[model samples]
Every structure is written in C-alpha cells, then in structure tokens.
Target: MTVRVLIADDSSLQRSGWRMVLESQPDLEIVGEAGDGARVLAIVRREPTDVVLMDVHMPRVNGLVASERILTDAAVRELGAPPRIVLATALELDDHLAEAARAGVFAVIHKDTDPESLFDIVRAAASAVDGRAD
Candidate 1:
C-alpha cells in the first residue's frame, strides 16, 4: 500500500530536499506541503495523509504545538487514526525529544541525517500506523 505523506517546513529548500528523498520510494506519496504549523494543521485536516514529516521549529505555530493539536483533535481522530507525525530538526536536544513525546510525535530525526535512515524511519512510521513491521 502507498503511504500518503505531507512535508512541513519553513524553508523551501528543506522541503525540497525531503521531497526528493521521499519521492525516491515507490510506496511513499507526497500528498501536500506545508510551510508552517498552521498550514500543517490545515493540510492534515483536509488531506488523507498517512505520515507527516514536520520541522520542529516553524515560524507561525511550530511542530510541537501542531502535533499536540493534530493528535488530539476530534475531527482528525474521526478520520480513523491521526497520521503519525515525525519531528524533523537539526537540533538533537533531549528537551525536544521529551516535548515530542508529550505531543505524540512518532519519531525525531536530524535534518542532516542519512537518507537511508530517514527512509527507514518514514517506512516504519507508515507500517506502525497499519500495525505492521518494516
């Protein structure tokens, strides 16, 4: 099955980079793109997204806040299960990880990490949503 993905980041270049990596996988589909937390929320609300790769730091709302909202929104939950959100950022702070956990983030990855690892994480997130292993 194909996994519909949404890329959320403030930098166009960052979004483009992630798009390139994700597009290389046949089972991953780029459903939409968002530049900020509010946009991420909007896209998730209307799109059939299976996974969301969102930047931890965004201009408008930020990933942590958006993630918490997405994970808890009744409207989104009614769509079945909310999409798995992966927090992507250059920072590797433990505080970020803790915040992500509180907000229900599936995983946290560095922006400069290996493409293969990123692919693996994305696949795992998708698989987890469907109760499978990657």
Candidate 2:
C-alpha cells in the first residue's frame, strides 16, 4: 500500500529537500505540505494522511504541541488509526525527545539524518499507522 505523507516544516528548503527524498520512494506519496503546526492540522484535516514529518521548531505552534493536540483530539482520533507522527529536529535534546515520546510521536528524525535512513524511518512509521510496528 502507498503511504500518504504530510510534511510540516517552517523552512521551505528543508521541506523541499524532504519532499525530494520521500518522493523517490515508490510507495510514498506526499499528500500535503505545511509551514507550521497550525497549518499542519489544517492540511491533515483535509487530506488522508498516514504519516506526518513535523519539524519541532515552528512559528505558530511547535511540533510537540501539535502532536499532543492531534493525539488527543476526539475528531482526529476517530479517523481510524491516527496518523503516525515522526518529529524532525535540528538539535538532539533529551528533553525534547522525552516530550515527544510522551506526546506519542512514532519516531524522532534528526535533520542531518541520511536520505536512506529518512526513507526507512518513514517506511516504518507508515506501518505504525496500522499498529503493525512499534
């Protein structure tokens, strides 16, 4: 099955870079793109997304807060298996990682992660949407 992915990042360059990498995978499809957490939710609401690649640092709302909202929202929860969240961060902060885990993020991807690893992460996260992977 093809994985529908939403990209949430403030930097256009970063988002475009990720789009290129993810697009190279035959089973992955980019469903939406958002510049901030607020936009992320908006796009997810309108699109059928299986996974979200969210940047931790955003303008309107941070990824952690967005993740918490997405996880706890009743309407969003009703959408079958909730979309898997893979947080993207430029810094490797333990506190952020802890908060991400508590927020129910599926995975944490460093900005410097190799393209192959990014693809692998998203592939695994796609499976997570069905509760098939941990």
Candidate 3:
C-alpha cells in the first residue's frame, strides 16, 4: 500500500528537500506539507495521513505539543488510527526525547540525518501504524 505522508517544518527549503526525497520512493506519497505545528494539526485532522515527519521547533506550536494534541484529541483518535509521528530536530534532542515519547511520537531523528535513513525511519513508522513488521 502507498503510505500517505505529511511533511511539517518551518523552513520552506527543508520541506522541499524532504518532499523530494520522500516522493522518489514508490511506496511513499507526500499527501500534504505544513510550515508549523498548527498547520500540521489541521492537515492531520482533514487528511488521511499515515505518517507525519515533523520538525521539533515551529512557529505557533511546536512538534511535541502538536503530537500530544493529536494523540489525545478525541476527534482525531476516532478517525481509525492516528498517524505515526516522527519528530526531527536540528538541535540536541536529549532533553525532548522523553517528552516526545510521552506524546506518542513513533521516532525522533536529527534534521541532519541522511536521506536513506530518513526514508527508513518514515517507512518504519508507517509500518508500525499498519501493524506490520518492517
């Protein structure tokens, strides 16, 4: 099955770069893109997203908070299964790792992670949501 993905980052360049990498894969599809956590929330609520690759810091709302909201929102939870969220950060992630896990994030990776690794993580997240072993 094609994995529907949403890319959320504040930088236009970052979003574009991720889009290019993800779209090159046959099983992955870029269903939506967002510049901040609030837009991410909106898109997740409206779209049938399987995985969310989100930046840790964003304007309006941050990735962890948006993740928490998505995990706990009754309306969102009722929509079959919630999309798997993978957090990405340019800075040190040590302090946020526990909180991200608490918010139901599937995984966290540094923004500088290589494209192949990024693809692996996203595909793994999608597989987890689908209850399939990767």
* lDDT score of residue 47 within candidate 1: 84
Q: Model 1, 1-134: lDDT tens per residue?
A: 88889999999999999999989989899999999999988888888788999999999899999999998888777776789999988876575998899888999888887889988888889888847555
Worst 10 residues of 2 by lDDT: 72-81
Clashing residue pairs for model 1: none
Candidate 2 on 67-122: residue-level lDDT in tens?
98887776676666678899988897665888999999988878889999988888
User: Measured by C-alpha RMSD in angstroms, how accurate is candidate 1?
Assistant: 1.3
Off by over 4 Å in 1: 130-134
Candidate 3 lDDT tens digits, 50-126: 89999999999999999998777776666768899999998988978999989999999999999899988998898
TM-score of 1: 0.94
Question: Model 3: which ten-residue window has the lowest total lDDT?
Answer: 71-80
In order, the Cα lDDT scores of the candidates are 0.89, 0.87, 0.90
The C-alpha stretches of model 2 lying farther than 4 A from their native spots are 132-134
Per lDDT, the best of the predicted structures is: 3
Sorted on TM-score, highest at the top, how do the candidates line up? 3, 1, 2
lDDT, residue 58, model 2: 97
User: Against the hidden reference, what TM-scores do the models get?
Assistant: 0.94, 0.93, 0.94
Candidate 2 is scored at a TM of 0.93
